[model samples]
Target: MNAPQVSPIGGLPSRGFAEPHQNKQQAAPKNDALVQIRCSKAAAKEVKRAAVEAEMTISEFMLVCFHAYMKR
Candidate 1:
């Protein structure tokens, strides 16, 4: 009987992760529609500042906020 082989902790790929597919033209995004929210200049500046502080794009920040609101 052969001794059992030990697996690495993470079981990650040994040769490195596969590269992203090349030259695959992506279809136009279906969720590209924009829903504009009008706010004061100061409010907009604060939103931008918050997004920067959170290390996220403005769109990502807004989506996070939306999800949080929906959760509540």
Candidate 2:
């Protein structure tokens, strides 16, 4: 006979934990239009300054911020 498995957290069965997060994900809809954003002169300048501080290019800095902002 097989011994019952033990949990690492909350002592709950492992199978019970996985599905809760999966169920909360939103379904994607059709026809999603991306917003076109124009960076203002001040914002552009800020990105340039940040890039200089990080020893990177303005485009690279903007890419980093774009990814972080999209994630949020």
Candidate 3:
């Protein structure tokens, strides 16, 4: 038996993301406040729910959540 095949989405570049922590010399704001990270589907749903319950923007809720993590 042959393995199943998957087709690519049209006209997209390959390997869209780069290695992290490799471009410290790049231009960026000193107080940049946003970051992006990959999360599992379940984790993403939970974050959204928590943010809504806290009546916070996603960024604010994430900052609060992360601070709570660091405090532990």
Candidate 4:
């Protein structure tokens, strides 16, 4: 009787793809914190527009603005 062919490497089949964590979104940095701001709808819209124009997330734009204000 002919024996069935087997992989030389005996283990779980290798997935032809990246591991789950490799494809996952990066975890937030340890030093980062979430801050919520309360504002009127008009103010929110203005901030969103400014962030978009600056090509930054609102948090990044706000941090830049805060640093600038601190330097003044």
How does candidate 2 fare on TM-score? 0.37
lDDT of 1 by residue, 1-72 (tens): 999999886895567677766544364456876655667999879877878887997678878878865676
Candidate 4: where is the Cα deviation over 4 Å? 1-35, 65-72
Report lDDT (CA) for all predictions: 0.75, 0.73, 0.75, 0.73
Alpha carbon lDDT at 9, candidate 2: 79
List residue ranges in candidate 3 displaced over 4 A.
Answer: 1-35, 65-72
Model 4 weakest 10-residue run by lDDT:
22-31
Q: Taking the tens digit of each residue's C-alpha lDDT, what string does model 2 give over 1-72?
A: 999987567675555444546435555456688745677999879877878888987678768877967886
Candidate 3 has a TM-score of 0.36
Model 2, position 53: C-alpha lDDT score: 87
Cα RMSD for candidates in order: 10.1, 8.3, 16.0, 10.3
Error of 1 at 68 (Å): 6.5
* Candidate 3: clashing pairs of residues: none
Please give the distance, in angstroms, between residue 66's alpha carbon in candidate 1 and its true position after superposition: 3.8
Clashes of 2: 0
TM-score of each candidate structure, all chains considered together: 0.38, 0.37, 0.36, 0.34
For residues 1-72, could you state the per-residue lDDT of candidate 3 as single tens digits? 999876777755776677667466575548766755667999989978877887997678768878866676
